[model samples]
Target: MTSTFPILTPAGVRRILLDRKEIALIDVREEDPFAQSHPLWAANFPLSKLELDAWPRIPRRDTPVVVYGEHDGVDLAPRAAQVLRALGYTSVHLLEGGLAGWIAAGGETFRDVNVASKSFGELVESKRHTPSLSAQEVQVLLDAHADAVVVDARRFDEYQTMSIPTATNVPGAELVLRVRELAPDPATRVIVNCAGRTRSIIGAQSLVNAGLPNPVAALRNGTIGWTLAGQKLDRGASRRAPADVTAINRARAQSGARDIAAKAGVRRIAYAELASLDAPGRTVYRFDVRTPDEFAAGHFPGFVSAPGGQLVQETDHNAPVRGARIVLADDDGVRADMSASWLAQMGWEVWVVDPVDAGLRSETGTVGHPAPEAEAVATITPGTLAGWLNDPKENDVAVLDVTASANYVKRHIPGAWFVIRAQLQQALEKIPSARRYVLTCGTSQLARFAAADLKRLTQAEVAVLEGGTQAWIEAKLPLEEGETRLAVPRSDRYRRPYEGTDNATEAMQAYLDWEFGLIAQLERDGTHFFNVV
Candidate 1:
């Protein structure tokens, strides 16, 4: 029997692009062909891996799914439609004439390996997705003292070099995981931006997808657009309290206090009782809620390094067990208390474990220094860092770069390697250690976190770059930059489709039935799909 869905002309898809409706454009093509070029906003789910775990990643079954492929006998669209329908997707459809038709219809394409990137761009234009205010809008908000949080979703280094004056760095992919920590006030409007559009768009959408209560928007076009509009962007760090710390503390305090617990319907633990849970056999996470640099400078043994803000963002990733006990430690109680509060609300057993004892406080409120050996941790000064360039001695030094991928690609100090903060713990082996280990980022904040983590996991002496790579640069250290292929695995490319004996049977039947019924729906709903013999 013939299918009922109408063949969507290129014009129809174009209109959808302009309208910004919540639809997914899927390109079923091999990786190499897709990397060469594909329409903007289209995501490639190669035919090979389509049957794997593609469906779960797609949040909604009823949401419109448009499928296409290069013009060839491969005819993967129909097969994809079948699998989607069998999996209970109600609105799967094919693109007419596939990519060839899209090009003929004047659609824009990108050279990126993933089609999802292009579709993401299309999502921005179509949804008329609310973008963060321009630099002018920010200026107005500043003048008015409006309750808005401007987040610089770039690498810490980029933020250090230049950013929206009032903006704080929170890296894009990290935001969804960290949103609750970054903006505890449900009333605060959260605005995310990057140096350019991609990360901003992805970051804002991630919050929306996660169903955060806060109103989230992207800074339109980002810093580039802001500067192009003749508006000034913030350069250099501000003296204001770090937004991450502030938000984290607020959330923690609220969660820890009995009154707030009564409101959020959660519980909190005492400091001593929490310490009791730290014994062996239990997977305990002791988090140091200080700037990465400060954490690197020195910290309590066995504490995982997490800047309070990033700790909140990546709590689940770092501490997957919702029931795991978390001990929050910081030089001061401010950040620890704050992070503890949020963790409590998230249903984690949390405590603000003070590094110093109460008796010590009575005698002298001064914190004790780490052991002298800890003080002797080997670190690379700008002057000595150059020696490691070619004939560097293996000093058991571990080097890590915690900056965003894009910035790391732009330029990085020699012998330094990149690791997304979230993935640092998992990828710890990448760093070679012979002497003392040093962690670096665009700023000392990330380095501090990494150094602390190294100390917790190993007995090695650890230090953070004094000011991170930025300080190294200021010291006039030699730098290197060029295309260096990241050996990291692509999470998106790796997927496994659901498989079962009843799967193909049910899938094939659902496929044919959907194809036949789609034509009728097209006439009634005015939706479109591709047609091929």
Candidate 2:
């Protein structure tokens, strides 16, 4: 009889390693055994941490996971595989002979590698190598007339509570995207700091890796370290102009108001025009860009809640229509206008509509209780879906599996690609343009977001698999079993590394020249493909 399960040998594991497959070689031995040695990159998800943190970080569900442990009559691999399979991972496999087999096979073992220690070490090494100036040093630099810019890499709340008087808060993740906005000058020294060290280390290293012309450094050990060294720490938030109102407006002006306005290409459409564009066969999205609480308070029927900033940042993920007309509803125009401006810059077709103007009831009717807007993007109905499934055309069909990787592995709609909702935008290129796409998730909420976003970004014919995968199974549709491979987009590779005070005019001009030319150099060296994220 043919065996239903496969036991992977050390040779098989080696092949996976060479190919860089996403296989986790788990050592299920007790703490004492694990403390002796483990494979490189092999994290000890100790049987203890298994149910808690280990399962969450396993990037893919269908991944060929290999488990091993001590041999002496103790077969932990089998039990581990069973648990993983119970967790809905369909492809759990046991290492042929556990750690003993690996040793006999002459496999290498790593000593003294733990996640926490490695992370801390990386933090320390980064600080030791990167340049940094203390508060006193910064004062001295100012006294000596040296050109430098200081930036605070902390959350907005922390920045508001306390920060260096001369530093500006540019949150860590936003640093790369907003770097050019912060420092236009290349000649000025760029200094980064956080409350302690980790953020500063990572932030400073980011600039260094990005090949910034200006010298970048962390404020050694950050604010605490500086204060401990008999130096002063600036308290109370810096009195700076609001970023949204002042900085954004200034940036718009510099980019050229006429040019920006032209690029925005905003058109005010009447309710009649909006209705004219709506068709039975076409997918349309109506968004209420307001807080969730406000949306729950009262909103137009059929409108879904997607806050303005998040909607813009995740436009490609939330609304994928490249040229899909978007109608945004908000009681006030400020939030809508701001969101529309950013969306336009990112190459989206967007329109802001006043909820009251569209014959919608006033939210004032409800005092305490609120509900999600009654308006939802018109989606495919079960009858229409059944009809499509019966005669599904190759040209007008696409299927997206939005379930977690593990769930998708156990069973999913045939031909549906596993698309992580968070990474949907980056996976756009992998999606085919030939057919209408159908999105399925554990529930309909994520499916709606996926379907709406896909329709908007790709402008491809789209539909949500009614009732998601659950309904698909209930209808007895054919199911396919396989592991899902994540699609990573080219744009997702580019990461920003610097966040500092606005550079001096001379430094700004110099840096711009360097950056413009570096792209060509990177391409010539054939190393431009490297990206942080």
Candidate 3:
């Protein structure tokens, strides 16, 4: 097929990065394959999720976008570019020769997701020489009942999965704010850990940067290290920082975090300054560095809820435009400044919305990306669809679920075939042809987009389920478990070696070794504008 998009060479991309111009280097493949190898700054969009994620992740329609995907004899770049163009993206281009072309040009490639963020963590440790205690040493403190406190810096769910014994779940951004309360005595030893190296290093460094009076150190290599030392981890742990923040502790935290943020050159901006960042040729990302529940209750109208810990751990996914301006917001004085401080050191022109006005938080509930305007497809209610499926005459209608493969396996409408939106056309060959087809997803948002693609492939009457599978379940309809019917291979999520307890000891050690060497990789890449403070 003749290519509709122009080609962008590796040299061209290097120039853009060096010049600090905004560009979205997107890898349009499944996350599992994309995690194996790609450019350091490239974000995984996955062709299957283009419509669902494009508008939110790559906000600007005209932002320079270079896409590439070639794995297992499948070339998805051209197809993805076509989809981008059709979605009104004006400046889409294909990478010259894809990943191989970049390699031939001496461009660096990195393994695993969020390579940029992980590399920066290593850079921070190398420059600052962050303090640490070996897993064996920490275990001794626990066994002797010493006056030491262990805090898990990963997300609560991860801590719940497996954590150090008696460790409180105080995530990265919360370390500065909550640690003083957790370990009240200045003489108390404070230990921070995560599943792997990044969060542990960053979390421990955060306290040191904040000038915490207590002796602070990272659990060397985190839970992975503990397991390697033949130590058992605690499962289903629920220990967490207390909910209430006393006025005195809150004031101390605010003062310390602000000082650190200033040292790192993070700007404290008012709401009025946001408009200036909206100028052409610039991409600005506004995020609320608060917990998901807090955000769901009420949040700044335009800001997305990205908890501070995960935001720093997954910057490439959160803000793909490498040189983009980031504005963070938090009602509490500590989280935004603490998060912004790390972002500033990572070479982002970041700002914290100082004194975030409560009145501006008019929006409430979980906000999804604005639904794109598409040709209206016919809709079928859950009750009516169930009646039709029960009737032999109307059972000819094909039900297609376009939700994530992981979610589909957990629970889905009984007999609904799981399909990848990107593979909808090819998958049609496997699905039996029907007089009419009804598409559904978690909430029918992705399904609505898939309906347009399905229309192009077949003349069959196409419709979307009203409210999708969730509605079916709410209507007291029976749901099926497991992958009962599959139109495409289940390869959406990449399993990380550092997550869970079943990983091989060698794989975990290799992962740590890879991270230990990222500082050298960063130097060779020469495009990362990191300036560790």
Residue 416 shift from truth in candidate 3, angstroms? 2.7
Each model's lDDT: 0.55, 0.54, 0.90
Name the top lDDT candidate.
Answer: 3
Q: Per-residue lDDT of 427-514 in model 3, one digit per residue for the tens?
A: 7989999998999999888899899889999999999999989999889999998999998887677889889889999999999999
What's the true lDDT of residue 100 in model 3?
A: 90
Candidate 3 clash figure, as a count: 0
* Tens digits of lDDT, candidate 1, 378-420: 4566555555444446444546676655567678786666664
Candidate 1: C-alpha RMSD after superposition: 18.8
The total number of steric clashes, by the backbone 3 Å criterion, in model 1 comes to: 39
| Candidate 3 segments exceeding 4 Å error | 1-3, 391-397, 432-436, 459-461
Candidate 1: regions farther than 4 A off? 1-137, 142-158, 166-232, 242-275, 278-281, 293-298, 321-323, 331-334, 354-480, 484-533
Which window of ten consecutive residues has the lowest lDDT sum in model 3?
Answer: 367-376
TM-score of 2: 0.36
Distance from true position, residue 60, model 2, in Å?
Answer: 4.4
User: TM-score of each candidate?
Assistant: 0.35, 0.36, 0.94
